[model samples]
Target chain A: MDFELIAESLPRLAEGIDETLLLAGSSLVIGFVLAVPIALLNLSNNGTVRTLSSGYVYIFRSTPLLVQIFLIYYGSGQFRAELQAVGLWFLFRESWFCAILALTLNTAAYTSQIIRGGLQSVPWGQIEAARSIGMPGFMAFRRLIFPIAIRQALPAYGNEIILMVKSTSLASTITILEITAIAKKIISATYQPVEVFLIAGAIYLSLNFIVTRAIMLVEFWLTPHLRVDRRIPPVVRRTPAPVPAP
Target chain B: MELSYLGWGDAGWGDEFARGALMTFAVATCAFLLSLVFGTIFAAFKLSSNLLLRAVADVYTTILRGIPELLVIYLIFFGGGQLLQTIALGLFGYDGYIDLPVFGVGTLCIGLSAGAYSTEVIRGAVLAIPRGQIEAARAIGMNQGQRFWRILVPQSARYALPGLGNVWQFALKDTSLISIVGLVEIMRTAALGSGSTKQPFTFFITAFLIFLVLAWLSQRVFLRAEAWANRGVRSA
Candidate 1:
């Protein structure tokens, strides 16, 4: 209800939004790149490859991302000497790197599943037709399968993107000055938890709204054939009226 | 630094970790139950003919689903008390430091989040029920309550089981976030143990393993429940 407090905090919170977007955007890109190979492993003909991919997915999905973050960030301290020897200690020491690493790993697990589902949904007949046309296996997959699979997976991937955005808030616990962290800082400073959180919530809500809309737009573009023209005139009924005598 | 740090003794944190795991289960159960209650109500509202009620449900699910669970917890934990104080002042004019316990607030926050997802699951399950089955029950002179209990509830349960299982897992994982508000659940126990012992790796790895065990066990239970629910039904 304190308009002045919310107004004063808005500028500070904007920077937090930038950090949030950075964290989410970078992780999503990395996660998607990682997911492709994992998804392929999931759909592999070899049992070991499939099982290994699924095991990775299960481990990530079963544990909370917060725990994973803590394990990588804090747990890595135990191996500081080994990590330093391998030149990886500096990355683990930075909270931002740890957050991104955790997020990417988590999202890769879920995204791989989504991608696998999409890949499986591609009809066998389509691949058969591609093969009949003498297309190479890799070319057929690259040109014919991948496009359809990605289109099929777009909606679920959009949901994953939104989740990743929301998850960036957890980075605050590790001292990342993301949106939620800034809001918490403001609340601590001004003692107006309600106002600051409301403002923060609105920012998140609007950001998600835009993301949802953008996803819908992409979906619309991907499936133009599915959209029906509502303005088209209905077909005229040609049945003759019943006789008055009847 | 030593494995004995995890042993059950005066110096080790074994007892604390065990207690934390129990508390985590308790919170997850309470929150899941609360979520089902909220979900049923909102799902009903969504399926109703009333436009206003449907809009309210839509807004509730959208806002809750979009926001991070961490932010939601912080808002409720910090603002819930203030809101309660304002209500007390306006109604009974009694204003003192009214404290809402951490457990209650943590359950409420996670419950609200879980409810949003559950609402969709329940609504979809209800919609999946065949319309003719309900109509047949009505034709047989069964009342609304009987029809709901005998026909709708059983059928929906079978369809809702898998989605509910996923929600349960989500609630269990989300309890980790409650540690931010100082709830001594598994995550918090690990944090405290790590900070005190200066062996962050050991404590956190222990916490992760505990969670994996819980998740694995619960998954088996849910799978069994799903099988039980599907018994005698022909598979497509």
Candidate 2:
């Protein structure tokens, strides 16, 4: 453990955090946008629609994300003509676009499942009550169902976010110089794997810690009903001593 | 577009991919089995009354789970050999440039990660076992070893199956990371074929399909095992 080396490399590695955060943040946002509809499709009344959506989830979930990244990045080179004709070639040509495309697709699959689980967990009785009140189906879903489901799903989605942050490391293989990629470069140069990786690992762990803490805050905010009034301590119950005569 | 590019022998990359797939399977299997060992040990540590043991297990799992799996592989690949060399030199005054086989490195890294997960699974399974059942075994004058073997192992194993299946899928996927370190697994083979043949789509898609098949098959195997484990137990 060379302390000096760590001190020197810390600044360099810190620079890469922007890329890491950008990659994870953008994909999560885009993936969430994609996930909402896929989740609905997953829970559709029609079997064909449900199966089609689920098949997308299954394939993405089953295969390694690295392969998926490669299939988009390197794999797109083979279809250059078609992609050019469709005007997707420009996006495919850049590693950033390919990486984000792969990541967005991957996270969408996982997020849909998490959303589906959240949707399933929303009580049927609540939905029925909304229906009885003559709330339109869309209104019921928007007002009664979506909020409760999202609150239920937030914790799991937090886990998924952490996983996505970690998944961003795979982007390094495609030449995106994120934190892990920077760590690899430093280690290769310094021949000090243990130290460089330890630093890199610390960065990731701390990033995850911050993300989780933020999610916890979000969870706290979202579930006001669940949040006990911690500001006021519970009143201690007391039994008055038996009075001789009252 | 050239179908024969995947044909067997000198004509194509079929044989290479097959061999690579086999290597991937072997690595995943070995890693998974190794993880079970680490999981049991750490789970015991975690479940122990001793504070030090519990802290050790907690740190192990948290650190392993927090970092990216790719970094874990890099740490082990680059750090492990040096550690081994140091030990050998310290013990016998015999030191050479000792390189760990990529296979062992791949297995060890994946095993360590999967073990962190399995420790939670196994610990949960242990906790799920009814306390009264253990007390009854004690009441019957069963020895500790006898109770563990007869009651604890079987019951906790049954409970741990589903979680362990997820861990196995992760280990299987983690093997692809080994290709980054030149393990020559399916991922590596695909990368090579793609680079050589200039058919990136073909090779990468094949790799993806191969993984899909492996994942599907293992999922079935896990389901069957779960059924077998839960046999004669009431569904309700």
Candidate 3:
């Protein structure tokens, strides 16, 4: 409705994209790292190990991320003295740190489950085949199991990345100048809610589009076997030149 | 942790927290049902013969699913009222300010966003129903309505339950975003309490526990529903 307003606000909102990417990218990286061990623990043979990991995943997954964010950010204020005693007050004092920490832990809970599913879906025979080849336990797990599981997991994990990106908007609640936050600031100030949000929404859509495309590229690379070899055409048996009927 | 902060009556926030939890549940229930309506309609649109209807449905789900829930709430909160007021003023010549209630806006935004997710799930469920089943029902002289009610609904409901359960959980968690728009849901209640008490950990942890309870209870409910839907079916 306000073309001029939209043109003016574009750059202001664009500035937030860097912060958004930083928050989401960092949280996703940490979440992925944390999820691997948690996933493995969930699949562990030891009952206690499995319970503890699944409990961690369950508790995190069950609760809302906003509460988790609040618990880490403002919640730490209640324990300032204790955190100070442990010399960890500095970390707790920073809102950005808390935001990333909350997002990381939350995403890990979801990602670990995805990873667990991927790991579980790996063919049992493959592990046995690795064992038959005299592959060491860790070696087999590292090379064979991890690769196959990652490939199996990529599609689901792609959805998780989109989720994580969308979730970085939560950081705005804590004063981080992410795209959503900046958009909010602009809209509230200018009273051009439709114009401001349309731009912001477009930014998010493009971000997610890029993310999904990257995931698809990874999936394509990983699943070479699923792709047909266009370089090599399928062979068709030559038809007999002379037909007896003819 | 200060136990007195959680005490009931005028002494503490126990009553408010309970009310807040109820509010959260109420909002989630309304939003989830609203979403089912949106989902079914959009699913039908996607499945219909009209290309324009299919394109509209696709655009709805794609854009809705892509953007953050917060933005949707904000857009509805800030932009939706303005749009409605313009229409009112133009058609009815009403000049009064149309202040959209936060609860309605929040629930609508959440429902619309959740509906996009539900559309895909329901569509998938409907598509999963075997084509031959419909053909056989047709051969047996069932009308479109009969075939849809008897043959399609039951089977798709079974298929849709698990996905719908996930959507419900998503809708539940998303209610927290409504707090940003000043709705007094669980997150808002916790925030108010924490700010006043200066004991953020106690109040937020309480909020988290309440959510955990809600999620756990609903999960069991979903499992039961899934079982109910799967009646007479043999599992491998």
User: What level of docking quality does candidate 2 show?
Assistant: high
lDDT of 2 by residue, A1-246 (tens): 699999999999999999999999999999999999999999889999999999999999999999999999999999999999999899999999999999999999999999999999999999999989899999999998999999999998998999998999999999999999999899889878888889989999999999899999999888888867669787999998888985
In terms of lDDT, model 1 sits at 0.94
Q: Supply the TM-score for candidate 1.
A: 0.95
Q: Summarize candidate 1's per-residue lDDT along A64-177 as a digit string, tens digits.
A: 999999999999998999999999999999999999999999999999999999999899999999999999999999999998998999999999999999999999999999
Candidate 2 C-alpha lDDT tens digits along B1-236? 77789999998999999999999999999999999999999999999999999999999998888899999999898888778887999998887888789998889999999999999999999999999999999999999999999999999989999999999999999999999999999999999999999999999999999999999999999999999999969997
Q: Provide TM-scores for the models.
A: 0.95, 0.95, 0.95
What TM-score does structure 2 among the candidates reach? 0.95
Q: Give residue B120's error in model 1 in angstroms.
A: 0.3
Best candidate per TM-score, number? 3
Per-candidate DockQ values are 0.78, 0.87, 0.89
Candidate 3 per-residue lDDT over residues B1-236, each given as its tens digit: 99799989988999999999999999999999999999999999999999999999999998999999998998888888889888999999997888888878888998999999999999999999999999999999999999989999999999999999999999999999998888898889999998888999999999999999999999999999999999879998
Indicate which candidate wins on lDDT. 2
True contacts kept of 1: 0.83
Query: In candidate 3, which residue ranges exceed 4 Å CA deviation?
Result: A230-246, B88-96
CAPRI verdict (incorrect, acceptable, medium, high) for model 3: high
For candidate 3, lDDT tens digit of each residue in A1-246?
999999999999999999999998999999999999999899889999999999999999989899999899999998899999999999989999999999999999999999999999999999999999999999998999999999989999999999998999988989888899999888778877999999999999999999999999999889888997669777999987886684
Ten-residue region with minimum lDDT total, candidate 3 chain B: B98-107
Model with the higher lDDT, candidate 1 or 3: 1
